[model samples]
Target: MSRPRKAEDPIRLPVPCNRCGQHHQTVARWPDGGVCGYCYQQAKRTRGICAFGHEGVLPGIIDEQPTCRRCSGIRLNVDCVSCGAEDELDSGGRCWTCALGNVVDDLLTDPATGAIAKDLIPLGATLKSMKRANSGMTWIRQKHVTAFLRNLAVAPKITHEIFDQLPDSRTREYVRGLLTEHGVLPQRDELRMRYNNWAA
Candidate 1:
């Protein structure tokens, strides 16, 4: 016996173009609206009118108004170089706060201490001027004193030995005072207690 034939699906009819009012075989509706292929191509090549009445390719949209590239340039945000903070860039490409803070930090951390040395030491003190002062009591600048103190604080060398090696008696006294005040050097009583504990 022959089997019954299945019903075929109906063909889709072409829709009329909204812009050209002509029926197109491949006309498709867009989310914003519908337009014929020819009309869409013409619109793509045409420059849009901005709110300022300037005719150009729109690069940005602000407050529902299209803006040309030149008009959009004013909205760009410049960031600081050092901190990445967003603001109008200064001549140095840094924000005011970051620029000031960086300048202060550089002044305090500069390796060349000769220029800043006088500010760190007592007035009228005679020391041999050298990049780094060692035995024989050569004059050293404030940067050298700062570097020595920082090294002593972080280095594993014995504190007394390092202190004795300082070129100037006055500088050594100053470093010792600072280390003592900061508790970097243990007190004699504290050392004696630690020894007693170890012995026990």
Candidate 2:
């Protein structure tokens, strides 16, 4: 006898993926366990001689032996049209990471000048280079976050005081911290300020 599981239990995501062991949203569940997008791509891209004479894209595992998808009767394919990379396609037949990159560019690009503000280039690059893109991707997906970034792209003044005047929230603080890191905003080092005050 076993207790019945609840129907409405909240499903927490970003758990350790069974394959890559990185925290991400579980995309596919195999006999082994849940797999993330990256791990899923890796598994699909696994290449070598199978137990049989087959070679290329060995994605089937049977009785401790890797086999071709056809041989093992596994049917799965996710290919990105833009980059021709075998990955988990998210939109317009492009991989999620690729989509995330495009989104970052669009959000950071200044409408007035049709280019990223010179000061914000580093922030755009940092967001693009993130190892796991979902966190920033998830953030920017929000209507408010998208609006904030778009507004930031056109702001003439990039200063601490200007930022302080905005309505405060976690998203605003996070962007401010990033700006400080890239020298777009002045660092808030109280000890250094105190030392300078004493010297003066």
Candidate 3:
């Protein structure tokens, strides 16, 4: 004695595909799964290949041609800063020549003093400017030079006064040592502690 089946219950039966003639079990009959999965995939792949001749899944179809991600120019290309020559840019966004041009060197030396030109110190023109006679250094301006000289003239007096205000001799000597190392003062043993470990 079996119970009657409900009308809403899904019906499953082997239905032959109209295209490929392969049989598959499906519930719906109206919009029949008449095309098998394999046939559908094959039809999709028949569209076209990319310009690079790769036969696989493509991201988009452009100008009636299929294209992959790599062929579409999606990857970024960074250029050199100075010459705009190389594809790979260095850390400072410049090529080797442009980066090396900024380095402090003997090229900026004064013929008279045999030292780095006084005008090139403390935010002055970079070594790159020395190469050009007509063009000026990009980093510094005439007004900046004026202001820098004014400040430089006053710095030593201010430093001396500050050192005089320090309470102890040891602290003063330590500061003097730092100043001497930086070329702000002449090197001398008087600016350091007199005692040595081996002294008896």
Clashes of each: 3, 0, 0
Instruction: For model 3, give the 10-residue run with minimal summed lDDT.
Output: 1-10
Question: What RMSD value applies to candidate 1?
Answer: 25.1
Q: How close is every model to the real structure, measured as TM-score?
A: 0.23, 0.62, 0.19
What candidate 1 gets wrong by more than 4 Å, as runs, is: 1-147, 150-155, 187-200
The Cα error of candidate 3 at residue 163, in Å, is 36
Tens digits of per-residue lDDT for model 2, 47-117:
68888887666666777677777786766665677777655567588766788889999999887889998
The predicted structure with the larger TM-score, 1 or 3, is 1
Backbone clashes (count) for model 2: 0
Q: Model 1: per-residue lDDT, tens digit, 1-200?
A: 12332332224425544544454433334432354555433332334788888664543446645465466542333457877854334447865445444433333332544233332232112222222222212222256664564444333343655665655446666555545555555444535644875899
Candidates ranked by lDDT, best first?
Answer: 2, 1, 3
lDDT (10s digit) by residue, model 3, range 1-200: 12332322123525564444555432222222344444433333332468888654443334645554356432323346767743333457764335545432333344455555343352223324354311232322344432332343334342444444444444345545545565655555552324431353
Clashing pairs in 1: 117-142, 127-139, 128-139
lDDT (Cα) of model 2: 0.73
Best by lDDT: 2
